[model samples]
Target chain A: MNSVAFVIIAIFTLAAALAAATLPNLMHAALCLVLALLGLASFFFLLGAEFVGLVLVFIYVGAVAVLIVFTILLTGRDSREHRGFNWSGVVIALAVFGCLTWAILKAQSLTIVPPHIRALTVRQIGQVLMAGYVWPLQCVGVLLTAALIGALVLVLEEKR
Target chain B: MTPTLQAFLIVSAGLFSIGLLAALSRRHAIFILIGIEMMLAAANLNFIAFWHFAPPPHPSTGVMIAIFSIAISAAEAAVGLAMVIAVYRHYRTTNVDQFNQLKG
Candidate 1:
């Protein structure tokens, strides 16, 4: 059933995220991150946001993951980092988690009720994006282009 | 609970804390960058899930924000990697702890 699939996806997503967080070797962590991203994309699909899911997978798994692995290959291999959790970090991390848990519950209780909202289809999103939210969308594109140029310039300087 | 949105938020929280730990625990510049990226991903996940559950009346800001976040994240990765390359070139290493020449 759909509900079963949702549960399965949630389990995979959480497991992959935990792996991404805790995986020791840089290479292994990156790999786990790829898995986590893929799981997230699938979750998007299950939510009926197929386009968003594809974009997540495309950008995170296809592009970001490739770029990271590329950097790994370009950098020397012998450089190793010590892997393990510190007591202080764990304590701080737990504190932060507790705060976030409280916030989510508090917010959920106060949210405006809309139990029967319709899922926004891809077509509906396109219409809204182009007509109502065009400015932000275009601004994002411009920023991405600028970033690409900056990356190229920096890389060139590095190579020189 | 029955795997509500709250559960997803908790997962995001755990991942985010892990990310913050990695960012703080390392003096290496590249690892710091990775940790930052992980945190960004966590935030993006929250945005997407919130959008899914809390749709606006007309134009969904959540989807638009998610799209923008993806673009911003891509930009960040590009810039961050470039900075890493530059730092590595100048010092022949990327460890933040090793850089002491500029302390004057």
Candidate 2:
């Protein structure tokens, strides 16, 4: 049952990702990206990282997807079709996948089944974030602030 | 049989490859950014899978890193889109091939 669910979700996610990658319509591509992110969140749920999955949905589907759509609207649509597809990228991507799959198959340790464990709780995550990871947390906070300001500054209109 | 760690790793590899394809082939700047985001998400999946499969007394380390990565990627997407918009304003088009001013 678990493997079955995994296969289904994997297929769905890959399909959505392919659409997002190859769609000619920008709006459709962005929406497909949202679908792909949601599929990823489901994979997180399947892995028992419920908090992480929820956060993924909240941040990715809520904030990031909305931002992408808004940016698409703001940027104004381009009626012209993009140039022909670049086949070299397809070759490179396939080669990378083959290499990664070969490496994964060669790793003897990776075939082990997952051990039963307690599901991670939000409280545990919060406690760790405040205690052991406080410094990194603080750093991320600063980085987010800098990013927010930098994005605004980058888009701000210059005075004549 | 339940999926093994290798299965998860392979899935992520496929995802990462798709992302690479998007980043490499797409002419639009937004598509490239989307591709990068997908790649980051694939890495996050790998981290979570490893954390999940590790033996007892599992550390919250992988979960923590995934959370942080999500935050950072959000910041990255914001900044990247802003740059995209700025570039569009200047160049008046989002086709990446046309931005060859720096080619020497």
What Cα-based lDDT does every candidate model obtain?
0.72, 0.92
Best by DockQ: 2
Residue-level lDDT tens digits of model 2 in B1-104? 88989988999999999999999998888889999999999999999999999989899999999999999999999999998998888788888999877422
Model 1, range A35-137, lDDT digits (tens) per residue?
8778778777765567778888888888988888777566544246554445676678778988998898888453443234467778888998899988988
Evaluate model 1: give its lDDT: 0.72
Q: In candidate 1, which residue pairs get closer than 3 Å at backbone N, Cα or C atoms, i.e. clash?
A: none
Which pairs clash in model 2?
none
Per-model TM-score versus the true fold: 0.85, 0.97
Question: Which stretches of candidate 1 lie above 4 Å from their native place?
Answer: A1-7, A82-86, A106-114, A158-160, B55-58, B101-104
lDDT of 2 by residue, A95-120 (tens): 99999999999999888877987877
lDDT of 1 at A76: 49
Among all candidates shown, the one with the greatest TM-score: 2
lDDT of 1 at A30: 75
